[model samples]
Structures are given as C-alpha cells and as structure tokens.
Target: MNGHALVVGEALVDIVRRAGSEPVEHVGGSPLNVALGLGRLGRAVQFVTRVGADERGTRIVEHLTAAGVALTPGSTSADRTATAQAELDEKGSARYEFDITWDPVEPPMTADVVLVHTGSIATVLEPGCDVVAELVALQSRTSTVSFDPNIRPALIADPARGRARIERLVTLADVVKASDEDLEWFAPGRDPLDTAREWLSRGPAVVAVTRGGAGAVAVCAAGTVEVPAVQVEVVDTVGAGDAFTAGLLDGLWSFGFVGIERQERLRDIGTAELRAALETAAWTSALTVARAGADLPTLAERVAARKVTR
Candidate 1:
C-alpha cells in the first residue's frame, strides 16, 4: 500500500508454563503478533496499542523495532504490562489465562495510515475499545479498516457482552477475520457460514473464518476462496491465526484493495503474485510453531525458503 497500516490492540506478555511448573515470559499479544508478522513480511506497519511502561513494554518496543515496525507513541502506560499464561497441550494447542491492563493512555494521530487493524482486547477491554473506535473514526477519513475478533472465551467475563462488542466492531471494519471458536462462542446453535455471511452483510467487504489445521476461507461479494492449510509438525500454536490474518492483509495490501492503491491498478496482477505472499505468511507461521511462543521468522527468511522450495 502507498500509506502505512496502523495495528491497534493490546501488547501483552505471553507466559508459557515451562518444564518445572514455572512460566517463562515471552513478548507476545495478538495485535503485536499481527504487527510483527506484517512487519516481517515486508509490510510497512505501525503499532497503535498501549503497553505498560515496564520491562515487558520495553521488550515489546525492542521487538517491534527489530522487526522494523513503527510506533505511534503515547500508548504505553505507567501500569504493568498485560500478561497471558498459555498452557500447552501435548498437541501444541494452548489454553490461555490473561491479566491485561484496562487503562489506556493517550491516543495518537493516524492521518497517514492506509488501513487500521483492530480487535481482541481493543474491542472488549475498556479504554482500548474507545481508542479503537477513535481510530476507526480516523480510518473513515484516512484509510480502510480491518479487524479480527480473535476471541478467547476465557478473556470475556460475559459471552453476551463480548459478542455485542464484536457486533459493534463489525459495523466499522471493512474486513474481519474470526475463528470457528469465535463463531461458536457468539452463536452456539447457528451455522458458522451463515453467521459469517451475516457479518459480511453488516458491511465488512469480506469475512474470513479460520479453521485450525484445516485451513481458512474468505467470503466476499466478488467471490469466495478457501485456502488449504499446510501440514506441519505440532508445536504450540500461540500466534498462528494472527499470522494467517497478517498473510491475508499482506495479500490485500499488495493487491491494492485499500484506497491508497486503486484496485483497477492491480487488475493485471495474477494469482501467482498473491499466492506467493500468502504462502510466505503460512510458511513463516509454520516455522514459528516449530518453536515455542512467538518466535516469528523474518521476511528474508521466508523469501529465501520460498526460493529453495521452488
């Protein structure tokens, strides 16, 4: 995209239970993971979330800078950084327990952004939601909007409230990514495809559903596409979904879906160009899962691996 992307959400620390009943700290949060994923994939990204002004927050900043992600500033607070405890199963899927800060500090100007990505605690948590709404309002004038309802039931004290919050977010987002779990959580008895279709009607240009291990599907009025998942050895899937969303965003950006680059200008681009970007994201995520926590690979590594595979 011609302009940069602004990723707004929480930047929490991930605590993984280690060998002896102790939790090892990691630099992760769903939004941070997405921003880092996008940044490492050669996307010009700006992180717009608040973190605690502690060592954890410093690590997040270091990690972002290392990944070449820009920051909007004035987001970090005097409070402790939000924390999450992930219990890994034998199959590498994790159950989470999070301790997140509710107070967000000051907001920043997002006038130059081409797209705004928000959801997660930015949708449900206090102050974060307000900040997200503010950013969405800015995107209405400056850029397109993308959101992922990265739903974790444990984080929502009330399911009804969570779904309602997500509904409110859907109205503002141009695109949305949700998991099967999020669908089931929102409407236990309703059909997922139907729910996604409903959300698409709610005004998002597209709605995507991620099915772990099986792959993901994107529904747009133009058409629908189902992406097959890569077969990989099991490792804790802490941020794979975020990686997937990052991949999708990368594809859309390169394709000129946002206003910064008109879609007509990219009409000549073929699926091969699009597929390469998506494939890189999936491959990087697969590599991350091969390790523990959010150990994401750089775009150069992904590109080099693609060349070898070819």
Candidate 2:
C-alpha cells in the first residue's frame, strides 16, 4: 500500500544450512525478496502475501514493515510459519525442502505501476494459486504484470500440467522471467528462447531468460537483446533474479517508460526499454550475488558503484 508496484507471493523464513549442518534462518521468498529489492531501490512497494499467524509470521511482518514496504492482511493461517530447509552444494547452490502452511492473500485493487509474482512453488502450492491467479487477472487490465516462474522440478511432477499452468500465467503477465532451468522443467524438448517466444506471443510484452554466468536475454515485440552478466565473484545465486526484477522496474522508471494505458506507449516500453532495463537489472544483481545475503543495493548505491572508475 502506498502508491504502486505490488509484489505478491509467499514470505517464508529460509533456514540455510551454512556448512551443511548449522542452519541460518533468513526472511526470504522470491516474491518477498523482490519486494525487499524494490524497497531498497526506493520504489513505493506493497507486499501482498500470506503467512501463518504465528511468531515467524509476526517477525516477517515486522521485518517488511521496518523495510518500509506495507503489508495487507495475508489471506491464510497455519499452526506454524512457513520455512524452507536448504541442502547446500559445495559451490553454495541449494536444493530446498519447504514446510508449513502455504496461503496467498490478494489485497483489494490499488493503483500501481506493476504487480509482480514469482516463486512458482508458492504460487502453485495450493489454495494460494487460485487466489493469486485472480489477483493477477484483476491487475492485468490496468497495470503491468510480471511473472518469474522460479520452477522447482521436484514439486511440479506433472510436466503437462506444469506447462499448461505456465501458459495460463503467460497470458496474464506483461513480463516474464525464467532461467533456462525453469524452461526445461516446463517443456523439455524446446529451446528456452523458443519457449520464451511462445510466452511473448501468449501475452507478455517481454520475456527474460537469465543465464547464470552467461548473462540474460530480453525478447519482446520491440526486438530482442542480450545483456551480458556483470562478472563478479559469486557467493551464491540466492535472490539474484529477484534483484534483477527490481532493476527492471527501476530501469523502466529511469528510462521514462511511462503508462501502459496507451497501445503505442506500451509497445515502446516493451521494445525500446527492455534491453536497458535488463542491463540495469544485471548490474544490480551483480551487486547482490557479490554480497553475502539477499539484500540488494539501493539505487543510489548502484549509481555510486557505476561511477567509480577502476
């Protein structure tokens, strides 16, 4: 609630096993990370998510409120708060096992520049998906909708149903973010960019496919461009894509990417702005993964970093 840009999905506490035994709890969820990312970038952000009415939920609320993002009452309750247990690899990548009640709450209609949904597991988990889909549809008409189908293959055992739901979401979103791995989970045979084109045709004005080290691509009706990754020493890829999403949103504002009300304006926004938006996204993401935690650098920090001449 404040002005614009709502980030919707789960807000869970991640218990990362730092070395493989000691678990460290951090407030995270892809959408929640994006909300924090946006908040750091000085965007007026509202996080619409559901968490159990418990100690962890209260902590998440307090944390987000402290960060300056307002929360509308999350639409679900559980005996315990949602949590993810991460099994880490030698390189710092993680495979997660999630527990707790998953619920999604949609806030009443509010004026905003965009509404973003990510964390596919959270969105498709249960009763949450139906409610989240409805909220997405409601905002699709008057606002820009962004989707990051951060798919976890183990969760979506049915490939066909997974692809179908992904397609349905494409129709409801204005922008989509998917890593190559995410594309592979949905449809194995086709190329990721090919799949992205399919999504573009479905509805999204632009589709972003992020390549961990290779960089990212922005495919749109305007045109397609590949933005190189900012080479930085990696700690982990945690919340990097969420930071990228925040970068895209802020880039749009900086590039004078204005209203979606007019057709021409929308097209211009899709074609002309995506590449630069993605550039900013990658830069911001670099700063995030280069650091230890999920908290992305603010706009001022980004600008300052860009200014320092090596």
**TM-score of each model, paired residue for residue:** 0.89, 0.91
Report the C-alpha lDDT of model 1 over 1-310, residue by residue, as the tens digit. 3677788888888988844567878888888898998898777888877777788988988989988898775777546788898887767788888888655544566566777887787778765676677767767566777888888777677778778888988887777888888888788998787899899889777787888777776666655666667666757788887887787787777666765345333333344544544554467667677677887767677667667767
Compared with the true structure, model 2 gives a TM-score of: 0.91
* Candidate 2 residue lDDT tens string, 1-310: 2346777887888887867467777787888888887888888778777787787888888877766788776433555677888766777677888874566656778666454555566566666776777877777777767888888666665667766776778888777888888887677888989988888888777789998889998788877889899888888777788888778767765665534553345455655467778989998999998876576888788988778733
Error of 1 at 143 (Å): 0.9
Best of the candidates, TM-score: 2
What is the lDDT of every predicted structure here? 0.75, 0.75
lDDT of 2: 0.75
| Candidate 1: segments with Cα more than 4 A from true spot | 18-22, 260-281
Single out the weakest 10-residue window by summed lDDT for candidate 2. Answer: 257-266
